[model samples]
Target: MAWPNPFRRRTAKTVSHYGYTFEWTDEHLSEEDAHKLRFTYDELADRVLARLDAISPPQKQPPSATATSTTEKASSVESEQSKPASRDLYALLRDNKDSDPVLRELWDQVTTVPEWVDWPQIGRGQDVFYRYGGPNLTGLAYQALLGGMGGARVVETLARTGGFSIKVARRRLFETTQHVLQVTRSLDALEPGKGEGFESTVRVRLLHAAVRKRILGLAQARPSYYSVAEHGVPINDLDSAATIATFSSTLIWLSLPRQGIFMRSAEAADYIAMWRYVAYLIGAPTDFFSTPSRAKAFMQSVFLYEIRPTQTSVLLANNIITALHHQPPGYASAEFLSASARWLNGPQLSDALQLPRVSLYYSLLMLGQCAFFAFVSYTYRAVDAWDRKKIEVLRKVFWQVVVESRYGLEGKTTDFDFNGPGLILWGLFQHVVRPQLHWSEISRCRSCFKLLPARESTRMYGVHALII
Candidate 1:
């Protein structure tokens, strides 16, 4: 069944979102993309798992059938149905790339770069993440993950995994954060076969496949466990597209502006392009983010079309805020987190999710942060040296991440231990302090307003206008 799209249209192809309207080509969301919900990554990761399971079947086995050659393919299908949880696609690729045809093909497919990819642009894109480190971190934490609980499919899968439960929500948040931080570590880090970014991304794909495979098995054995018809296959293309969009488009347009930080035209394109490459590697549709405008439209469409906040959304949102409360000395507070949810997601969705009200303390902190970020962003954008210095400080704060293996998969796990008063102080002031004001006019002021009342005052005022 095709999931109804609010933006799917024939004539005008325009949709209203949060008081703004966006128009995209009919190519944006096709019938094929819609039905992709019923499918997962079958060609590579799924195929590799199917083969590995039979070669090394689980220790437990069902009674052998009396039949033989006539049912060769049938038995392969049955073996897959009750296969081992996974054979560690990454390790299997490492151990058997030369010996296993399927694993070799899977590795080859992901490592090869498409003709459209610009290596230099990809390198620049990696820099964009760290360039505006504080706002991006804030956006991912407050808006992307927490705000994303409104999705029916993504939220449902996360709920089943218990990753977002109060007990492990904090760990879940850091685990995800670590992947992002690692992926954008450096330009060289993104090169296929050599970079950790490429390796991490491929490993992450297998984890998603594992979740889908496990959940599919559960649903088959107990039909009531999950309704594929209703919820779509776990982490399908649209969901994957939405996941990457949350990290890219949402941060560029919605989240950063909420903190009074804005990207230049080139900066915005580079950031979107960076995530587009990630989408390509993970089997998500890359065309959706081919340009800055297209990426923004995709995010707006997902926001209006996909967000259907239920009680589950409310529970997850609260869990996220509570899970990160008082994380480190002077680092974070409930007042800040609640206010951030209210600010980043807007009052309507936040209220729908039943997020707590923003207290006066939250308001004052937001005010202080907006003014500070605007100053910082403008000051650095105007001077190259100052920009580097700002990024250095911001990097030190978020770079305090630790990588760990979980569920018996190396390079497939992420955890963070945030401590130390000095680190906490810098991180808190930089990322923990929340900002809610948006200043769009400030973004273009350098070119728009150069002439002013006085000569010397004009340059400084022009810089200030860029931050206003």
Candidate 2:
């Protein structure tokens, strides 16, 4: 009689991804993708179950084979495992990134830079980033995570490091804010070389290089679950493309009108183009999202094929909401964060993530915030000089409130490094050096709980200030 292994879990049915039916072959597959192609879903299930059975307690041999078992264990040790042939992993990763046919095919089909897309016009687009569309950056970050963490590999990796935990909120928000500022500054740079430098900073490049190295190493180390040979990169070119599209097209462009904020077509195009350029600098594939329309289409395709409702997504979203619940100035309540997420990603995604339903009053409050912004958006474009000036004052007040909400008026920060493996290391460090701060006891912002701050006395806009 055999004892059944509980670990030998089987999925109810094989779910096909949206783009899986495309006539791609083994030659076009990554080692990870190709490894999967070697077996049908049923065969793979059978193989997994068989492996589980072999390792099951019932299958253990008697003590007579102890010597053989010891010898096998010695060989199976991590230090004794046979090393692969000497080759550059970085070179291999670059080759994979460049040679991926699926990504190349998608790029060719989707990318279309318009003839009138003036590269210079992107400079003017920075005004919009810090002005009308600033508050929605948080929503965009949530959207990116919602999409990126859909993959089991990414979510599991993030989960193990405890990065998605509540204690890491300040660090995460700061890093995200840095990235946002970098993109905005890069677009507004006067010198081509200076602009390139901002995009390709040593810290930024090192951070990207470190991340790529870690991801590939993770794939190599965890072959059965995560394989570069099987899946390629965890955050592959397509994922990066989707991320760029989500930020530039989906969150920025789509959210504006839905939130009742308005922008002229030309202004929107400039904004998209600016982000398209940022996408290139971030090592996302060139020309894949050259136009706003292409970005939208790419986002749709990615959401269908790559993004899905998974336990992993829910776990990450839980972490984000918990973390935001702890962070400074405290206007962004857990309820507001949940509601904003629902507003941005829709009810299906919100429910999939197991977020609590926001109350009707909060929903109306969210709409009111949007309406106020929509008024600001329109008033900024008024022909009269004084009308526009008053709007600018309002925009300044909003910006001050946002900054204070995240980092406070003095912007006090912990001495942790903001570059290299800082975030990665910090998240891991929290498990040991855990600071048990009582989040709810922290003081709430007077502005958010009370009336809006006076526009005349708002702080000067120095942090990532717009050239306009």
Candidate 3:
């Protein structure tokens, strides 16, 4: 059913950007390259084969080890050759559709790959994330749409942390912006260890692992408050992780197209492919959706099956809007943020989050901003090479506003004071009081009423346990 993109033009041609010309086709990749793009069978099969060999190996050593090895290799090659040559996921998905009725039904009426699966262009046009007003727009979109609607469990966790609220909100926001930028850079390159290796890969991995550890510890300490059914299994399970990851991948692409920061079908494919690889590295399940269309499907599934907003969702959204309102540069206002939330999430969700109704002035300003960016996004490509300096300045200007937002308010002060007895007692409770509950055998299962893990001493439990 799928071949050579028959739905599109097939005439041999050249396209040029920045004096560079390249062919556009589904065949941009060689067969070997396509194989490289997908998963490898040898890795998975090796583990199962190794276990089988250990249990059922020949008792006697071969008389000639070399001959036995050669025979084994020959058999392996014969088995491989007898099987289908194409083992890539796309191929496997198609081949298994008949036997796997579910797979067939899932993709049953789907055709032509959504008209937006242009991988080649996406790969080459990775600059869209930062070059246009992508950072601001996406940051806004996340606050309004993804974070606003993903239920109480995820947002409530952030709210209770108090890390970004009481301790150091400015620093947290800066770190978040940096993380977004780093991910953008990594996606542009889209290789495991390329371009800011630790920043791109290890940083996020460690952050996610630390988050998991902290959540597990919290659940263990306070079963009454946090539990599997409430928080979702594994704390950050496939569904939640997929939602969070797609916010940056598919959601970003979806948001940008309206603002004139558009990506071709192939460009969207490359963007999603980059994130899929990143999600794998960070230990998030990528099996749900390997393409943008599938990601969109996964998103739709979220609304129908996953999300159920509550009081906690409202509190978290309010917290996010409040924090953004205080940040420097003075642009993110209550009215502005609420209006953007309303526009992005629609009236129903906006009401769910309890966002104030849109203000006329802010709404018009936001609209103007989008229109201006759309103009720039479309026209600037012709002058992109020559406009590097201006683009850099624009990037700097955005960050400058961000920095000002961090520390720019009048009468700003960092001095914090609390009652002396209350302060000392709270410290004692955190360091001295909390430890007793943590070490107590009875306290271990006080909330959940389940057996605690063997290594409880090594784990810490408290609000400050996992800040990063």
Candidate 4:
């Protein structure tokens, strides 16, 4: 027989078997042998622990008094340097430039002189043009809107363009080169005669990185609502983030020594003009008026007693003839005539053309125009009788005009611009003026009275004259 296969197993059935029986080859290991090859949990745990114990512990260090003292001294030096320098606005302006001989001489005298920082707060009206006065073109534009020229499109356009220009200047110019110079100057000043080193350079780089990151964060949060075409080339995709970053960086550059000395001076002049324009729009405080209060009061008396009476007669004559066609039958004609006469004779009308009251008058003019439009629609049953589609479109335009008008009314003139006025005027022309002048080409003309010459005002006014 061939040699038996040692790994082979044999199985058999027996008549008197006590249990199922099986046979293994001699080459196969027994159960006890298999168990001997394996390690128990206890043995594995011991082996791992023994290996870990073989590694050595790190050595400890003792405290050093000299090193501690050095650290304390370094911290004290840092604290001294951290204190901000006392800034003199005038001196700050002078130290930056020696190129202008006139300014250089002026700067020399300014250093020895004392000046008011907050001139407006100190009751010095002439000093309001100074940088510290807090009123500028931006503030003036805001005030003008509050006075009633709430032209949303125009304000918004101006704000967007102006903001973008400022943004571009700050990002491409101030933040990059000028900011670096400022940082270097600050570092040099802090070190006395010592030059800036690698450490300061690294710190400046880190600060720039942080500022850029903040700027990026703002840009990502408030993406531009307007198109690149709207802002122009420099600030094509400028968004709120870019705007905030630019503003912050510009403010920083302006505050730096020497960099913004001349720029700030020029800006001060612009600020005054802006403030005056704004003051004109909103009716300035009584104290700001050139004439005395008594003089203004006397003028009011003259206007009410003399000038107004003549105007009233003219208005009465016009209303009497116009009322027959426009007014409903019965007491309507009489009531409108009486109201017209009363309004012409009213103290409010006299005050309307005066300082302070001009704002009120403008407001009333706008309101009356709106009310007259509404009255015409009601009288002709035009709005209520319109098709659903026309009504919906009109409704949308109405709300848009109203909301933008109100925004313009609020002191948010910077929020809109000329475009806003155009849009409102367009809406009014489409909804109100269009219906009344459907037969005339003049009525349909979008730019009818916008820039018409003074001579054409009467002719154009007649062309769009309301039946009401």
How much does candidate 1 score in TM-score? 0.76
Estimate, for each residue in 66-98, the C-alpha lDDT of model 2 and write its tens digit. Answer: 355766777657554474332222222223424
Give the best candidate by TM-score. Answer: 1
Weakest lDDT window of 10 consecutive positions for candidate 1: 418-427
Report clash pairs, candidate 3: 116-265, 117-265, 118-265, 118-266, 118-267, 119-266, 122-267, 327-405, 328-404, 328-405
What is the lDDT of every predicted structure here? Answer: 0.64, 0.46, 0.41, 0.25
Q: Candidates' TM-scores?
A: 0.76, 0.59, 0.54, 0.16
lDDT of 1: 0.64
RMSD for each model, in Å, please? 13.1, 15.5, 23.2, 38.4
TM-score of 4: 0.16
| Residue 339 CA displacement from its true place in model 1, Å | 0.5
Instruction: Show model 2 residue runs off by greater than 4 Å.
Output: 1-119, 141-157, 160-162, 186-202, 222-225, 229-231, 384-468
Candidate whose lDDT is highest: 1
lDDT of 3 by residue, 1-468 (tens): 001232454356543321112344442323343223222211222232233234333133233433557778788687965743321222233455465544354224222223333445444434444455442344334432334344554454554444335234444544444444444542333433334422234333433333444455567888864566545543254433444444444344434643436665665566566555545544455654476666554444334333457776776566556666533323355676666555555455567667788768766755655565555555655575734543454444333333223332212211111100000000000011011123343233222212234344542232111100
